[model samples]
Target: MDDATVTAPAPDEDIDLAYDVFARSCPSRHTLEHVTGRWGALTLGALSENTLRFNELRRRVDGVSEKMLSQTLHALERDGLVHREDRQTNPPRVEYRLTPLGESVAERLLSLIELIEGKMPEVLAAQHRYDGRRPA
Candidate 1:
């Protein structure tokens, strides 16, 4: 073995993104779609801690496109999960805080995420066994 070689644990961010959907998409599924969006869960999680400006939110939730972020926020706002407040100032200041319903949803989502995190190792092992190939 090369003594100079070193291996640190790989980032778990990618693997942590599996449970990002509900059932099949349909025209009637408006609110659930908004609540279960790509950035929605993370956005809710961030806002659960405290109010944040749009830029701050973007920075906190990694790997989100600007357009997608705006869309997600707007959808949540329309559905009442998020509260968007705009300040009438020179540069324009905006802040997002969760609504009461949003807080409840955030709590549930966080708990679900925690459960997934705890079982992820076992889930991956089962997946490998079912597929007959060890994880790389």
Candidate 2:
């Protein structure tokens, strides 16, 4: 594992139940935000399929600027959810893939994405109804 990569606790270790995201000081909250952020979500989803080059990821994500994509990748890397490999060649090549931990989270994220997308029509209808009832 990379020096920055965080490993999961061993099965025999005790888990901390007080590490609550709602408390605002939990470290997990920071990781949760990074994983669930707009660009992060899309980037992870794209990488879940296979390793991808920077430009390929940008294209797959759609509408993400090069700078934003870079930042998002860096954040995910720091959080140990993404693995970046650099191949030193004449033209230079870098590819991104999910680590084992990342793959686990990405699967769950994909499921959530499917659920939200499936209910989008209902969400839109609710929004319309709420908006229509408001005074002009």
- TM-scores of the models, in the order given: 0.72, 0.85
Q: Clashes in model 2: which pairs? A: none
Question: lDDT values of the candidates?
Answer: 0.81, 0.90
lDDT of 1 by residue, 1-136 (tens): 2223233335664443222223343322476767767688889889999899988999999998889899999989987899999989989999999999899889999998889899999999998798886455
How many residue pairs clash in each candidate at the backbone level? 0, 0
Highest lDDT scorer? 2
Candidate 2 regions off by >4 Å?
Answer: 1-18
| Best-matching candidate per TM-score | 2
Off by over 4 Å in 1: 1-28, 133-136
RMSD of each: 17.1, 5.9
Q: RMSD (Cα, Å) of candidate 1?
A: 17.1
lDDT for predicted candidate 1 compared with the true structure = 0.81
